[model samples]
Target: MGNTDIFLDKYKQLENCAINEFKLPPDGSAVAKLEKRSEFKDIKYELNYCREVRNLLQHNQKLDDEFPVEPSNKMIELLDTVIDRIKNPVRCIDVAILDRNLIWRSYEDRVLPTIKLMNEKNISHIPILKDRRVVGDFSDNCVFPFLLGDDNCHIDENTRFKDLKQYLDLEAHPSEVFKFIPADSKLSYAEKLYEEARNRHERIGLVFLTANGRSDERILGILTAWLIIGQ
Candidate 1:
């Protein structure tokens, strides 16, 4: 067949992939549904344009026994890209900093050195792990409470994460919060969570990807706004 036939075939594959991947209603407009997904936000216009082209190709009358319009190579390439994205959706774990590469500290680890490292690296948050599981997190927000809790509270060579235990709890930070998501969670879902938090005037300090999206589970990876923004 011609390029028109190939375009139609690819478009059909995209629709099917999207329907099965996103569980979109078979009777509804796939492009419309995809528009609502964060993953498709960047290509919304292209998707709509492709749909319009498909409609024209199928319904518009042919002239001189030839199709009225032909899809461009770029358009076909876009369809292929969209199809690939649908079949291999980016997961939160794909962008997250894996535990092995994560910059973290244990409760017994010296706090001063960790803080120094954070300063040098411009890291805003540090997870405190115990038994290979997240017990709490330390950040600039934790500093205020820890220091004001007592007149003698101070950070020195002897200071350890255990000393800031109370302030390090996930709930201890009033201005920011953390979320646990399963390793296989779609990146779009994580983006939605962050957007929802922004709508509520709250901030998501970090997202931890675990085996089952539970705080008590072993941490597999971590997501930050910086990481998501990069994607």
Candidate 2:
């Protein structure tokens, strides 16, 4: 019934937060499992410290001289951060951070200087759309590789996106290299999709955020690997 109680209560709150975030039962194992999640990786060590303190306090009848009777300011901050993160995950568009800088390619527009733009701006992927709705992605990987292949397909600024389709193999097609996620989705969901793509040996060059994670939804933003992996 003192500072130790307050600290213990704080840790208990964090456990509950993790439970809700993971949709698991309120138990030590659930919180432990959440500690290993990528979204929570930034806070893993901090959560570890809080867990240790909570464990010591719960198992002891009295405060030990070895432990700080009152949780430090840093500990309190850690608790607050973990709770906030678990309760409110940062959305895909929020982390995309390049919302204003998003480059676009209209499916009907003639082929662009994709490599030149990518080099000048250091961009890895650009979203291609059909009348404001995301249709697919255009990445430097597909561009350079296609150019290296047979030159039978005449590609120039006058070339249209549909024209380039014939030159690109199915594996290297722009349409096959992107995924859609709702703007409101947690970045974690996007990460899982990327992992799934990797398991299938397909590279997801871009993750386009839209109204409802649909290809036909108006493009709201685009997420590159750099942004998704944390930037």
Candidate 3:
């Protein structure tokens, strides 16, 4: 027989079996005319639990004569949905070059107009340069050395900002503290640089001080983790 014929025959058999258990109309037209409002509403939870029980029985799990199945909205949400927002975060990452003309100083000497420039431009960390060479990466807190009694805590106009020449060239303390991350580095590597700064327990801020690693260590940019995320 055709698929439709076979389906109709099975449907008739099911209707006969159900009619044997309940008082069903004998006339096909009377049965088709029967109208009843559905009593069940919002039974998806129960249906899902019953499906799970059926699966457990098929899998040969413990099948008791009578068992209770509890459904949790929390587990349903977890298993049914892809939580991408929690697993992955969107972070804007970029780099900016440090202005070579910029100067810096402690809290003492006339407040160093560069500090005001940095504030006006929304620049948080400013690197003190002398003769196109980096002297110190100065944030708002670099003024502490001058607040104590240090008279020479100032970026003189004639001083040259030391460039990152070699790996060993960055061995100086507050004076010659030269450290930087490349602009071509990945975001994870940039994060690691900031993490290392945190682990050092020093004021050595995470400065993505950019330089041309190919030609020479030219001051191309200066950045931080905050700048990376902000980008």
TM-score of each: 0.94, 0.83, 0.39
78-112, model 2: which lDDT tens digit per residue?
A: 77777787788888888774556677776676666
| Model 2: lDDT of residue 199 | 86
- Selected candidate, larger lDDT, 1 vs 3: 1
Taking all chains together, the TM-score of candidate 1 against the true structure is 0.94
RMSD of each: 1.5, 3.3, 20.3
**Ten contiguous residues with the weakest lDDT in model 2:** 166-175
Candidate with the larger lDDT of 2 and 3: 2
lDDT of 1 by residue, 1-231 (tens): 888999999988888888998788887388667766778888988888999999898788889999999899999999999999988889999989999999889988999888889999999999999887999999999998899888999999999889999999999997998999999999989999999999999999999999999999999999999998888
Error of 1 at 119 (Å): 1.1
Which predicted model would earn the best lDDT?
Answer: 1
lDDT of every predicted structure (CA atoms): 0.91, 0.71, 0.41
For candidate 3, write residues 91-159 as lDDT tens digits: 212345444433444223333455567788887665544444454455544444433435554544432
Error of 3 at 195 (Å): 2.3
| Superposition-based RMSD of candidate 3 using all C-alpha atoms, in angstroms | 20.3
Q: Give the winner by TM-score: 2 or 3.
A: 2
